[model samples]
Target: MKGATMKTTMEKLGIIASYSRPRVSNDNPFSEALFRTCKYRPDWPTKGFATKDDAQAWVKSFTGWYNEEHLHSAIRFVTPAARHAGHDRATLANRASLYANARSQNPERWSGKTRNWQPAGAVWLNPETEISAPEIRDAA
Candidate 1:
């Protein structure tokens, strides 16, 4: 922000970050998703922040909660911190066991297999399809 106009906006809002590179509107999906999460948070202020400090403090708290506590559905409901610390594998195994036990206790209640507690293999903003051996052979 080179002008006073943008500075006023910043003061009212807080530290504004550009997720994309300089002079580019092409933000990656991951950054876009994170921004969505921040905007959709239950405690996100509807009105502008009283001061930039207030906004920064709120963002810090949100980041902590997101990393340390929030269970991500894409990652088998484990916190990013837990996954980063290599604790998610154990956590997922425990959940799988618990689900299996519950299913055994009331097998008829379950219409299908219990939800997969397996750790996510990989994450891609835009996943590409790989050709299977059978498909390649048939094509050839």
Candidate 2:
């Protein structure tokens, strides 16, 4: 009601989004979880920008990475792309098959012992999920 009177003075305006008649905070738990994730992400750049363009660019980058590369363990560690494409399950199956085939093809390629291969020697790839590699390839 007060918003109608001060419409001219408003710095920003948005629709009065309303939820179904549930006073429980659980009704909006998803949004709360999102804010929690945003605040907790170590890489979330929080410093204000001098110009709007800078703010827009940062938002753009964050959106791209969030939607493309971020993996949610709740969603089976698959990127949003895989989930959107409805191929998350298929993609996972393919990856598993590839691993099995690779191991079967050349057991010597991967030593019997597990190798520490995160930053250097070897790497895993995911093609279906935007979090995945652009292309699946042998571990470097």
Q: Which candidate leads in TM-score?
A: 1
State the lDDT of candidate 1 residue by residue for 39-122, as single tens digits.
899999989689999999999999999999999999999999999899999999999999999999999999999999999988
Top candidate by lDDT: 1
What is the per-residue lDDT of model 2 for residues 83-104, given as tens digits with 9 covering 90 to 100?
7776676766676677777888
What are the lDDT scores of the predictions, listed in order? 0.81, 0.58
TM-score of 2: 0.46
RMSD of 2: 15.7
Assess every candidate by TM-score. Answer: 0.67, 0.46
- Residue ranges of candidate 1 with Cα displaced over 4 Å: 1-28, 127-140
Q: What lDDT is obtained when candidate 2 is compared to the true structure?
A: 0.58
